[model samples]
Target: MRSRRARVAVIGVVVGLVTLAGGCASTDDPKANPSPPAGGIEGTVWVANEGGHSLSVIDAASSTVVTTIEGIEGPHNVQVGPDGSRVYVVSGHASTVAALDATTYRLASAAPTGASPAHVVLTPDGQRTYVTNYDAGTVSVYRPDLTPSGTIDLGGGPHGMRPSPDGSTLVVANLKAGTVDLIDTRTDRKVAAVPVGGPAVQVAVSPDSRYAYASVSRPPSVVKIDLQTRVVAGRAEVPTAPAQVYLTPDGRSLLSADQGSKDKPGTALSVIDTATMTPAGSIATGSGPHGVVIDPTGRRAWVTNVYDSTVSVIDLPTRTTVATINMGSQPNGISYAPRPPAPAEPRMSVVLPSPPAESSHGDHGGHG
Candidate 1:
């Protein structure tokens, strides 16, 4: 959500008294679901610490930050290459897409983009990477190496988006336009703009690519659109304001990261059943839970609680939070990749200094 500046500003008191800091489940207890074995949950969990100007690299199994790569100026979101070879981040202030070596957290390359880049997505096949330039009203396209390929003028506030599983289409939620742009992946051109109720915040496409779901924040609802016909099929009203939306690996349910405002932060994740396009239930989470992503194994979902500055590990089976991880600052977007282990002695780059990993109490940027 581009709501970061306002949200952080609303609660600047918590941001001070430190650069202050730092979870899931129906019980909202880390112990509700016991921690997994060393290899139980594989891969790396990447989080964009917007306020801290850093990214938190966490080992999924141990729920620990392997390292913090600090220096990104206002990283709104991050995405890992499908093969886990690299991670791409879109910095709103820097107006560039920074690609880092996944193995050593070293900056490899970067390409310029339009104003206020909000989110980044890599095609599942690793063929291309896409970034939403929020203020520019365009989506930036790039080769796998962060090479600029082209740009699609999406018309307004292009925010959260995802490529269809087959990599055929990219479903993008245009916030200011209040519409969803279905862009043909092959051509990088807009195929259609289907209207949502209002201010579409984020989107999730069905596995088959037959349907696309868009979340509207004003009225707090999820709009289900038929991708094949480009029609709004159904809409379900949710209780909390939704940020990022995710379709479970099995495609049975959709999870909405309900990150309400600072005055009334969301305390749960809203669930919608795909079968009926209706409310299934809710999973308790930390305050202002913004970014939610499920693991490759489909057994757990990790979420970033923005206001709390913590990450919650959810045990999918029981819908309970298994662990809460401390983070640096405002953790916005999250992405996971089944990755190999790092070197014996990993070192940080001279450009990217280490940021203090805070608990639920500290870290705020100069929101003013």
Candidate 2:
């Protein structure tokens, strides 16, 4: 049973939008599953403005808002495909997941999921997409074409999910269950569940895929779990309420966007060293930093501040915020896409041997 507020939120999106398609497909059908694109479009950050019901595209280099896509109902999370061809957005209020063209930012397709589809993550291979249903206690699986493929039951509030770097496993943070569900993507089934003793908000797997770090809100800590043993390896203290956690590209540092206390209003990002399992330092961000994503180069990090309706760009090496860009109302979700480097200009074959010979002879005469 959902609360009245939750019910109202779910109902709000249904009023004026077209109904999403509802159907399921077999995972083994080759025609139903297409391989992900080989490359992705780079140099843009996509953000989900939950309150504004829109998506904001920001130019990574200039830190400017390129565009704001309207008409999305409660866009709670946003993710770009590995190849950068498509963008996926989860509308919790609409109970739907919509796919948009990565370059044009137009709606490509959409499909309904369980109640309160909160977060979405695509497989590294880009063949599949997994979405966590916050209130339904389930995860919906979709093919690359945005067709619903199947569903996995977790019996808890499934909020945040991430696939391993190798695409072998999917780690889901069950917010209400206070446990982490590990799913083997090969079979698309839950293989194990580890209790973390608090409500889990987000999960980030190591680059090597050996461990997964989960942010626990109740005790204000992040728990490290050994993927092989399926047990709690260690824990590190964080801020009062950590909304999202992500690992750096090098897997050297784990960053948490701590949404500080309501009275205090948190504006800090907690940095944890993976080796020591302790807090290394904290970088100040905007008010209510809820989501974070690191650039492909690992030099800069972008964080969405919900309360302030802005995004803070952090310089990782200096551990300081370099700029803050104003976003729409309550920007909650963010993702990074690496832009392809510009092609090098063609070089002209200049004949400089005659000049060099003259310079050599003249320099010898001057020395003599």
- TM-score (all chains, Cα) for each model: 0.85, 0.82
Model 1: residues with Cα > 4 Å off, grouped in runs = 1-39, 340-368
Per-residue alpha-carbon lDDT of model 1 for 296-341, expressed as tens digits?
5678899988777788888887888888887756788899988744
Error of 1 at 148 (Å): 1.0
Cα lDDT, model 1, residue 53: 73
Q: What TM-score, to 2 decimals, does candidate 2 have?
A: 0.82
Poorest lDDT segment (10 consecutive residues) of candidate 2: 359-368
lDDT of 2 by residue, 30-142 (tens): 12222222222248888887766677777676665666677776677899899988889976555678888775566787777776677989999999999987667899999
Indicate which candidate wins on lDDT. Answer: 1
Misplaced by over 4 Å in model 2 are 1-4, 7-42, 340-368
Over the full model, what C-alpha lDDT does candidate 1 score relative to the true structure?
0.76
Lowest lDDT sum, 10 consecutive residues, model 1, at 359-368
